[model samples]
Target: MNVCTTGCDISSIHLTCGWFSSARLINPRVFKRLRYNDCLVNNGNRLANGHTISFQYANTFRYPLSVSSVRC
Candidate 1:
């Protein structure tokens, strides 16, 4: 899991996984919006994989826009 506070600019983010794992991002700023690009891979393993990425905002009043791209 990753948490960003105070000036954060995630223009391009890359993630590579080989097991059943996941990533999460937590942003606490309400006024500022979060934008990022990501890539996810699972190799060639035929095992049951439950990989995913999620975003959480502390402030629920106004939800910002999030853009992402994933490749398996």
Candidate 2:
């Protein structure tokens, strides 16, 4: 997962994956929409072919988003 909160533009970093994951940004000053494989969310995103994930937030924040959970 990737999170950019320090005025860093994450436009050049191309990410592709074949698993269930989510990327989110908690910054309240960045309004960057995300492009994903499953659907479009304002914050972080997920690229899945036929996977199901969980989400709880609506409405756009700074809008910058994406994340993944590393199971230990």
Candidate 3:
């Protein structure tokens, strides 16, 4: 993890089951989400390179993810 030098973003990255979800940068506004079922997502697994790491994930099933976000 060595890809944090200021501004960076890893957003809207869609991944299915058995797939890999990775990010590299230094953006606090980086958003990640899930919409399907039986899928594992990691929002802080640095694979390429970056600063600041976290272990955020979710398991979606049945209905779609209900999120009230600012549509901009």
Candidate 4:
């Protein structure tokens, strides 16, 4: 996932998901979680200045999606 915080700058980011992955920059403490397809979630602390969150999912079998991002 990709997120643009309020005035905060994130030049670039990289993540790899064995089965699944989720990450975000919040409260100066970036949170990341990985798990299987059955279920996944990234419930980290909210940014002190609030947060901009994004999400992504890759195909397990078919066309492989390397990455996904969203701007908030």
Residue range 1-72, candidate 3, lDDT tens digits = 235454554322233433323344323334343443223223434333364334444335322433232111
**Cα lDDT tens digits for candidate 4, 1-71:** 33434565432233333454324233222434333322222333332224454444344454223433312
Error of 2 at 72 (Å): 15
What's the ranking of the predictions by lDDT, best on top?
A: 4, 3, 2, 1
Off by more than 4 A, model 4: 1-7, 19-51, 56-72
Error of 4 at 1 (Å): 8.4
Write model 2 residue lDDT over 1-72, tens digit each, in one string: 224344433222222322323255434222222434222222333323333333443443333334322211
* Per-residue C-alpha lDDT of model 1 across residues 1-72, encoded as one tens digit per residue: 123443432323333211211233433221122322223222212212233334443432443233343222
lDDT of 3 at 6: 47
Candidates 1 and 3 compared: the better one by TM-score is 1
Among all windows of 10 consecutive residues in model 4, the one with the lowest summed lDDT is: 37-46
List runs of model 2 lying over 4 Å from the truth. 1-49, 58-62, 67-72
Colliding residue pairs in candidate 3: 3-50
Point out where model 3 deviates above 4 Å: 19-53, 56-72
